[model samples]
Target: MVAGLLGAVGGGWLVTRMRLFPALLLLGLCQALVNLGYIWLVHSGPNVGVMAAVVSAEYFFSGLGSTAFVVLVTALCNVRYSATQFALLSALAAVGRVFLGPIAAWLVPQVGWSEFFVITALSALPGLLLVVALRGAIDRAERARVH
Candidate 1:
């Protein structure tokens, strides 16, 4: 709960201070770091402090990352098709979670906790790359919204 609240606060700050793509990139990076923290938590072995810190970081980043996603979705929606588009995008996000669960479960045992989380953490890279790749488009869209 505390971590979530922190993430909410961080996300709100990001929304106000930065453009959508930059904010999403930052949030995505934070998410990847948080996954690394998970590997540390798993290896630390019975250390409550490590567990708390990792869980907190995880919750904070995940919530903030989710908020970024929602913001991006909102930015992308066309008013004419917003209802359906938003629903579809949001559902796809939910499906992503579902899809990852089994993959994570299966991989964790096969590759070990550290490697699994590392792979999961690195998964953020593609989106970050896309953000960079589509910077011009994102900027134009935001500019269009303003003017």
Candidate 2:
């Protein structure tokens, strides 16, 4: 947890030098570390009950985080598209949850704990790339907004 916090601070500093979209992408990559920690804790020789508790906590925190993200996304959307875009974003989040269980099941057994975490961390790379790719557009759009 200490290391994760430090990484977040460092990443945030580094990201500040980047344009908006890329910074958001790096934010996603940094956020993925939270999942890595949960995976580590679950696989760290804890008993089933303890593991379940940890898992529950993780999910609870995740839902909180998702709510925050959704709020932010909603805030970022144009007024004209607010309802439709927010609905779409919420739907995508639901789809992500649906796929998560299967993905975890498939990867956890095959790669074990350590490798599984590495892969989970790697999963954020595309979001980082998306931010990079969309940086200019994001900046322009944001700058043009009335807000």
Candidate 3:
């Protein structure tokens, strides 16, 4: 919880200092890579230290990524209907988790922990790619917010 709060504050500050697209992409990659810590935890067995480190890293990065996501979504909204659009976009953001929960459950048994973590890491690529592709759109939205 402390780690996550720190991360959120850090992320908010970092995003203000950097370009949103690159910051978001970097944070997304960090979030994805952090999942690999679980692979180590699973293999090492009952070590509380490793577990604490992994959980802290995971929460920290998750909070950072969430901050970036909120900023991106807010930037994308128009002032006229910001409330409605933000609500809709926020709900859409949750679709992956809601839909993928069962898939993740099934996937673990089929692929084992390490491979599943790898795949989870790889799953971040598409979203990152989408950010790359939408660079122009994101810039335009940022400009709109500024003006």
Candidate 4:
């Protein structure tokens, strides 16, 4: 609940203040920030307070990132096939999330917790880079979103 609220607020702020691609890059960066919390947990071991805070932070950022992603997918969709495109994009995302879980499980054993989290953080970069690459499309989406 708290995370959802924070995420909505973050999303609202992003749409109002920044263009789509930049907002997406920012959202990805924020999403990546949560990995540091997990890294802290691995290094310091978990205290109840830190654990709670980290969990909330993770959820908040996840919510924000998810919202931004949904918006981006929606923006990218053709108006004639909006529903199908959104569903397809969302399904692709779900597949990625599902597969990543297993890959993470495999990776954790090889890398240890801290490195795993670092790798997790690094994973966010590609999305941000993609946003950079798609700046033109994003601007068009932003314009469409406005009017």
Report clashes for each candidate as comma-separated counts. Answer: 0, 0, 0, 0
What is the lDDT, from 0 to 100, of the residue 138 in candidate 3? 87
> Residue 68 of model 3: what lDDT?
90
Better of 1 and 4 by TM-score: 4
lDDT of 3 at 144: 80
- Tell me how far the alpha carbon of residue 7 in candidate 1 is from the true structure, in angstroms, after superposition: 1.0
**Deviating ranges (above 4 Å) for candidate 3:** none
The residue-by-residue lDDT of candidate 4 on 45-109, one tens digit each, is: 75888888888998888888887888888888889999999999999888878878989899999
Error of 4 at 21 (Å): 1.5
Pairs with steric clashes in candidate 3: none
lDDT of each: 0.84, 0.61, 0.93, 0.83
Please report how far candidate 3 places residue 87 from its true position, in Å: 0.7
- The candidate scoring highest on TM-score is 3
Misplaced by over 4 Å in model 4 are none
Candidate 1 to native Cα RMSD, angstroms: 1.6
Cα displacement (angstroms), candidate 4, residue 108, comes to 0.6
Query: Tens digit of lDDT per residue, candidate 2, span 1-147?
Result: 443344445544554455455446545654666566656575667577666655554454444334334434654677898888878877876886698879899878888887887787788777667667866767776566524
26-71 in candidate 3: lDDT tens per residue? 9999999999999999998999999999999999998899999899
For model 2, what is the C-alpha lDDT against the true structure? 0.61
lDDT of 3 at 100: 100
